[model samples]
Target: MSIRPIEPDDHAALLALWRRTPGLRLRPEDEFVPFCAYLQRTPGLSLLCERQGRLLGCVLVGHDGRRGYLQHLVVDQPYRAQGVARALLRRALEQLAGLGVQKSHVFVLRDTPESLAFWSAQAAWEARGDIQVYSHSEESP
Candidate 1:
């Protein structure tokens, strides 16, 4: 698989890949367009992994001039365990470091095994003391 920067042309394929992936909470196609626009305009960066002309995985790197945040890391089920996710992640981290980011963080849902296992297996990932996750309902004030 080859990893490369995400392009405007890749938006549809990436969104379809996410929807087809079992573990992901799918979002509408239009919902991704604005985010793509933001990535195109800001310092944010995203990458796509393709094999034999088919999109296999993707990763997004977001930073606020300080810590780096990793999001939307999804590898197609057929390509899982073939190093696609790892390659995308390695690329993201390298790019973040190149930008002088001191630290990086990724938030995984509590019950997502693929995410949990991936992060847990990384030696650099550490869980600090007394971490709490906060969430709010969409209808809440």
Candidate 2:
């Protein structure tokens, strides 16, 4: 398998992957226009893993000049437990560090047991009990 930076052309394939992945939650930001805009906003930070030109796994990464955010970390079911996710994460963090981003966060939904387990097993990541996240949507008054 090989790892590479995500390009605009990969969006369709990625969407298919995300759709099939059980635990992923897609939002408006995942649509084509916003996805491309995000790529433009933070270039070379998102990535994919593939073999023989087939998409195996992917992770979306970006930073706000202070902290990095990771999203949509998914691997094909057949490819799980093979270290694909870890490799993607390591590479993502390395890229963020290169951009002087020292800290990163990934928000996993409480309903996704598989996702929770995967993150819980990550030795380098810590579950934050001291902080709570609140989000406001523009669509919501």
Candidate 3:
């Protein structure tokens, strides 16, 4: 498979991919616009993996000038276990390091066993148990 940076044009295909993937949760109310803004905020880190002109995987990585974050990572079911995820991650980490990111983090939902397993296998991934993660919606006060 060939890997490259995700373009604005890839938005639709990426969204569709996420829809079919099990672990992803897409937001409602014109989420694409916000996603575009995110791309503008952190460019060149997101990536797509494809073969024979068909998208097979994607990795959304970015940083806030200090800490790097891997927001989304998914490989087409057929492409799993064939190193696609690893390649995408390796590329993102290299880019993050070049951006001067001292540390990186990724989230694995409690329900996604595959994702948890995939990240757990990586030597660089440190699953935090002592910390609590809290998030709220934009509509929340």
> Which one wins on TM-score?
2
Which parts of model 3 are misplaced by more than 4 Å?
A: none
Give the per-residue lDDT digits (tens) of candidate 1, residues 61-110. 77888988887899988789999988998889888888898698888877
Tell me the tens digit of each residue's lDDT in model 2 across 1-141.
999999999999999999999978899999999999999999999999999998999999999999999999999999999999999999999999999999999999999999999999999899999999999878945
Off by over 4 Å in 1: 27-30, 41-44, 135-141
Error of 2 at 45 (Å): 0.5
Better of 1 and 3 by TM-score: 3
Best by lDDT: 2
| Residue 85 Cα positional deviation in candidate 2, in Å, after optimal superposition | 0.2
Return the TM-score for each candidate structure: 0.85, 0.97, 0.93
RMSD after Cα superposition, model 2 = 1.3
Rank candidates by TM-score, best first: 2, 3, 1
Candidate 3 residues 75-134, lDDT tens each? 888888899999999999899988889699897889998998998899978899899988
Overall lDDT per candidate, in order of appearance = 0.79, 0.96, 0.85
